[model samples]
Target: MRKYMVTAILVVFAVVTIGTYYVQASQETPPNYKLTTVQGDASLVEGIAVYGNYMIKDSTFGIKRAYITTNGTDYPDEKSAISQSLNRRPMKTQLDQWIEEHRQFMRGKTNTSGFYENEEMLAYVNATVDTKRSNDSSAKRNAKLSISVLNKQKNNTLEITSDINVDHDISDMYVQNVQLIDQQLVAMVFMNHSASGFVSEPQIIRVNLTTKEIKNEPLALPGVKSVAADGDTQYAWLANQNLEHTDQWILRISRNNHRKAYQVDVKTGQISPLTFQGHEMLLNNIMNAYGQKIYFLQKAVSSKENIGFAVISYDLVSKEYETTLKNTHIDLSENITYAFKQDHLYIMGYKNFKGNRLYVFNLTSGNLEYEGKVISTEAANQAEDEANMDLNFIDLGQF
Candidate 1:
């Protein structure tokens, strides 16, 4: 009887302990465990959206014209859009003027038979000229976005809605992005009223899909540089700098060199500071989140000396930065553009001015998955190695 009682008591205690552990585990759910599956050309995904069984692609940069495409039908067709915000002209500086002058001089000097004697030097000249042109062109902001909804189940009928127009007091204002947040789409616009000012404050336009009501309001924080939104959590990284600085280069360097990140709750409008262990200059841009981890790109302070960058992971629950990927060979500062899709981070850059190469890294294991050439050496020289400038991707839980 004594032996049996002892054995029964031990079994009961074991069951109770196991039960308590499971209850605790259930209460503290791990980061998003949803299996992420990615297909098609990951490089081409600039902005993405999912509706029922369809994936909407919003490819904006590098290309001559930005367009949206739907994958619902067998034959995908590009659709044009009308931007919700006003176009802002680029503010030119002394450096820009110098670049323009130098480019013109190069064109005149290499005008012999439409080519120069030294091919390599000619490529460098052409690349510099292209960079100047891109900088000059990006200043004049054009169309924002025009949305046409489609129902795959309903014979792919495109429902064209009346476009929303932004009220602009100045021409130097443009829409930064139109993103889907919490099943509701909103447009973020940066308005530059001061022709002499370096930085412009941001404005938010909330759109109601059902009612088509547009509410335009100034963002709570003026220093908010960029925002990364997910289904559960929405956060914006703010860079506070002296906007009164006359020179834009100085303003940008200060903004990049000194900045702080914050977590903004969309529901309660509560803001909390995000603390991490690293120099402010290291954190360049915040990429989309995977599960409960927020991933971001960090450029080293002195790129000329190190020529390296890092990938930082910040855990929401722990409120800490988990990992930093910095290798001697990984030259992230040289990258023109980057994208994080599914489980991989893609970086596009030129290899010794040879061609554009795509470097893929697996986020889960924090490993370099693959590296391959995205463009030919000749093409890279011709386009000035800015072919991958259009890289973008929609967040995992955005839709």
Candidate 2:
């Protein structure tokens, strides 16, 4: 009788432990949405993954990890889990976790444009100004160049400072973009004339990482009075909202709406005008560039249930504009996100708890190569899904 009681107690304890574990696992697992191929080769999107922020109605909820593809080549389920609800478990998305694990040193510093990272080191640049003010013209402003670098191999960080000269009227300086060329740190900066809210003057600043010497170079343009910004207005952005390492930067600078495009060589500081005088076609359109061609979305219309736009492309090699997708405009629903990779354009439409669709376009041939829709494998509670309805994709990459 005593032996039987002990056995029964052990069995009950084991069952309770297993049940508790299952409950925790279910809570951690995100809603499963599988991709279903509707046309062409769906496998083309196996390398692309997108991560986004979720908003329920009006407030911030959490983040969605890298997207799941139909094929097994994308982000693994074990690693890519959605982080939901601030009141619940304080978990981070897969993208955030990856950045933390891989580029741990750049956790807080790389938010702006003045930073460069590679497998060996991560570099950052900024300018610091002294509070002392003087009336004499010869007394240059007390400004210092701030540079920081993290060596991944040695697990060491180096901080350097150098004095920089500026006129008395210059009030502030900001680093826009940074590059490391031949052991030298190059930073594109914007200098404000005063504290007033207005456009800034564009300039190039260079610092020797070893010698800690600072040098200033003036950025000059032809015809266009200013090259401060890339046609970005006070409220709108027209260029591709992505970053990549390049030897040349395309700049659109204009006054009184006569916008003209120019390419600047990062190495030689040479400025050459591009033939694309596309002020009408590029205004208020989302554009991304690949190779010598530029793709843009125009005539974007959004309603309660659907969103669509016309696709157009301009070739720098041929100096010609062409309309993609024939006479048909792309029809998507709710929110849309797109990215360029592997000579293909990947676009997705997702909303609420229900599954959505994916469209792939071959950039070289200008044809729709594949279409896929997401299929929900598991049922979700309607109230919970409603609380997590809205989403905004913030990042895209091959995860």
Best by TM-score: 2
What are the clashing pairs of model 1? Answer: 46-392, 46-393, 82-145, 82-146, 83-144, 83-145, 88-173, 90-139
Clashes of 2: 0
RMSD of candidate 2 to the true fold? 11.8
Candidate 1 local lDDT, 108-161, one digit each (tens): 322111111111122111101011112342253232323333332342322223
User: Each model's RMSD to truth, in Å?
Assistant: 29.4, 11.8
Clashes of each: 8, 0
Native-referenced Cα lDDT, model 1: 0.39
Residue 298 in model 2: shift from native, Å?
A: 3.0
Q: Using Cα atoms with residue i matched to residue i, what is each candidate's TM-score against the true structure?
A: 0.42, 0.59
Please report the candidate that would top lDDT against the real structure. 2
